[model samples]
Target chain A: MKDRGLPARISCGPEGSNMQYGFVTIYWRDMIRFVRFKTLLISSLLQPALWLAFFGIAMASNFDAMMAGMPVPAGIHSVGYLTFMAAGIIAMTTLFTSLFGGIVILFDKNWGLMREILASPVGRNHIIVGIALSGVTKSFIQALIIMGFGVLIGAAFFAGYAPLQIVIGILGILAFVALFALGFLFLSAAIAISMESPEGLQGVMTLLTMPIFFASNALYPIDSFPEILRVISLYNPMTMLINGIRYFAIGPDFYALGHHYAFTQMDIALSFLGLVVFSVIMFVLAWWRFRKAVVT
Target chain B: MVQPGPAGDDPIILVENLEHTYGNFKAVDGISFAVKRGEIFSFLGPNGAGKSTAINILITLLTIQKGRAVVAGYDVATEPQRVRESIGIVFQDITLDRDMTVWEQLEFHGRLYDMPVKDRRDRIEELLKLVQLEAKRNELTKRLSGGMKRRLEIARGLMTRPTVLFLDEPTIGLDPQTRMRMWEYIKGVNREGTTIFLTTHYMDEADQLSDRISIIDHGKIIISGTSGELKNTLGRDLIHLETDNNEKAITLLEHLPSVREITVRDTLIVLMVNEDGTRVLPGIIDTLRDAGIEISSINLKKPSMDDVFVFYTGKDIRDEGQGPARPHFLRAGGK
Candidate 1:
């Protein structure tokens, strides 16, 4: 037979031990899928703005009227309800986007695409880390869109701040958003790897989002809740994320909904720390699941 | 055609007493074999006969539950990363992402193996031509025909110039014409010096494509040899006879020196003959006629792979409307 100039076999020597960026490959493929699905791309970007436009406007008008006659502390800054919930909207969009980010993993597993990845030389942890990175990217995009659109529709985000402070505030919100998105994406990946079907994963996501979105202070204040729910909301990572968002977007001290909103530096720091801790735990969980997973 | 490696060279793949179980069911039960370098080896068996499970274990997709597997000189359990690096796989099912274009599918595989950009690009061009997929490079994988998808997978498997390629049922679900074309591509690949380990249920596939064949059933290697050697084990020729009285014909032929073995399938009697069937047919006909028995039908032919498979496995591999036709006798002992 003719040689056909086939490449020689790769030697498994020290040269083969060079650092492998397999996760980047995984991330690249995911981004291809993200861009290739036009409907998915448009819907994910538009969903957050629609929520801000319709829900934020209707609720803000009602809450702003009800709090018109309430007393504001002499030195405190009083903001409209639209401004208050704009931050909430950002956090909400991030929550929805991040929670559903790992759905791709489940789809790949079901459609047999995961077998190609698992059988390759890539480390299993790369899959988890790669998915988390892309999830964070999606969340960042959605959060930025909501921020821009929320301001265009009369929500006073970063109002009265110097240009430098606006940049800092945006970065701070993204820092919190990145940490929070990582936490949920890891959790989503863990659940997805363990699940057998897409329907089962969807059911679990619904079960989770209901308690997480409503129980936290995203849509309304959690202070007037019953004693048990108030305590639960205090420890909820969603509440921690919103705390960071409000502290950066709004001022340190603001009043709305007949309640005084004040965040000490220590409170913001602890909330940031809470997100870090949550994400770390979630990473460990996802890593464990990936290590245990077997795909053929 | 690629010649088999010399006897002294180490085999590309080695498995010794390898066993695996899922809960209480042992999927790969104590099977051992080796694939020499520069040759095509096949594991031929029916579905659920542990072919896929064995392939999965060799590819490092499943944890090694028991025994040892060394692929391309790396121990699968202790050095799976090295094994994975040295081998490529075409899984039983289509594993392509529907949205990714044909070019992207190959690109993704190259990147997963950490191929340099220039090499990845050049190899993609070369393989696109090799598989005749250049025109479909920009089309989505889902848009390609089933045969095209299988060819793309084969190209992807060759991206890193792996030492060994594992193909599990490569031409499954394709038309007959496409299957023949796929065989040519596989042979073309083997000629280029990569060892191939394939598993299939099609008898002709194993007989035509493999340099060595191992017939597996119920997670055990029942027999292994070249296709010629396997067919030779059933003797020179096979004689099929349908007589009014099969039991009497069997009784008459059991004592003949040329009749090596007799198998009864329904009313048909299959005789493995030691001499040429043409010479032996006259004696068998006279013997049956000397008695009151009369022959309803008769067929004589050289042993084919189908007959060899039936002789050993005692049943046809295809799952059609017909029920299992287990031969009453003639179970060939394993090597």
Candidate 2:
């Protein structure tokens, strides 16, 4: 018979840890499942690419003529509408992927696998981090795939920046993606835990996210909006994220997407800092909710 | 062979008047018990008898409400992670990730327990072989049959090589052959050193497998002992007799030395005998025959856990589910 005691060579760390191995284990499981679900990859990638192709092209000419008459911000030349919307599409893809992350937890709860995890020696905080990290990773990769589509379609904004700048921009996009994703993931997880069944959460998420999507500057220039919507979009976190990407990826002059165009050094720093704070707060709230939840 | 900690030493699991409530409903009332190291101890009860709730508290899954529970030398509430590290559970509900393969499932569990990479691979292979699922290693869990899923759950529970394994109705719906095989696997595991605490309503399973059993009813442990002890408490044999003259037969049999207590049903007379039922069956028949009573039929039945349950609870465990609690004395009258 084989040795039945604790495996002789097994050791994951110096001692049994609180979260490291468990976090990575949960993360790896999510990644494995993420890779296996080819349909998910295809659909997530497809929708953003279609948005870039259809809406970017269909509306570009009209936007181009309209934009020529407007004052161009300092430090940048005129730009095509396609490039402006490419970043928005990237943000949208990130939102969509991250927003649905809690569906996996819902499935786990429905399938009773959450109890298996709950009963494990892993820390509850680690479970939250593992799941959140996995969701952020998925959202980042999905956003990058859409960005790849933007590159293939020859969005002039991408070609305008140096290769190093583009890579840095992708990293910047990931930060924004992580923030947006974490916020939505937290909201989704909270609703999932409190709601009786998953059937209503999806409808609720769509209703919740659609307002956030349309109320911001994602699909259109915030400057063109009515006074009240302009105020809403001005303060909307999505607008801040898109604005941060606009300036960080292309240049500060590309902040022309919004009514409040010029961003000082502090403006850029504070925007991302706000995202960091929001992400952290969302994480803390989500963890608290998760700990309080009873998985029948 | 790996040996367990000495028998009758410190208990591997201990509970002291543990209580839990779902709002006002007492799911697990104040019940206390201890399981010896390396013993197959079972909590026997019908549906909703608080078996799962108790197991959940012990496994560190559910929060303990009133009293204390210690598993593997750690308080369940205070050191839940330590308790969790020392235990594994096969839940009554199937908790498999249906999208994943059996290998992936075991690997995930091994990783959670922080097993090293090489050791994890080896253990996964061994476990898959043990469960006879090596051939289906790549098959997704959802594609597996119910029996296969249960086997995988058992294998996953062992992936961590836990010291205490909690099996909550492990063989609830398996076929007889599968159940026997499951028992063999469980016995083999226990022999190798793990202390097993299981909960099941199957009397035969408790009778055949457990070193001791606690019969739980309505959140309280009514009685607990070895199978033989429990059966012996209910007396040796229950003799059922059918006769044309029920009143005359009851009058005549009431005075017999072997028969301790006689309870009359609508048409059948049940006698709790003080001796081996078969030993005194012929003598009782002869005495009754001399009394000119025509005996229609007679049967000598050994006391089972079912009888023990009825004897202790004063009601059928199955009947308790249908309505509110009846008066204790009414049930004690044994209708």
Q: Count the backbone clashes (under 3 Å) in each candidate.
A: 0, 0
Q: What stretches of model 1 exceed 4 Å from their correct place? A: A1-16, B1-5, B320-325, B328-335
Docking class of 1: acceptable
Candidate 2 chain A, poorest ten consecutive residues by summed lDDT? A1-10
DockQ of 1: 0.46
For all predicted structures, in order, the TM-scores are 0.95, 0.90
lDDT string for model 2 (B1-335, tens) is 11234764888888999998888999888999888888999999888889999998888667787899999998877777678788888999899998899999998888887788899999999999988999999999999988889989988998888889999999988999889989998998899899999999887889899999999988999888888988887678888788989899899888988888776545778778889888989988998899999999887788777677766655566567653342121122221
**Model 1 agreement with the true structure over A149-177: per-residue lDDT tens digits:** 99999988898999999999999999999
Scored on chain A only, each candidate's TM-score is 0.93, 0.86
* Candidate 2, residue B21: lDDT: 88
lDDT of 1 by residue, B1-335 (tens): 22346868998999999998999999899999989999999999888889999999899888888999999999888777788889989989999998999999999999888899999999999999999999999999999999999999999999999999999999999999999999999999999999999999998999999999999888999889899999989999888899999998999999999999998877779899999999999999999999978999898877877777776776677642243557543222211
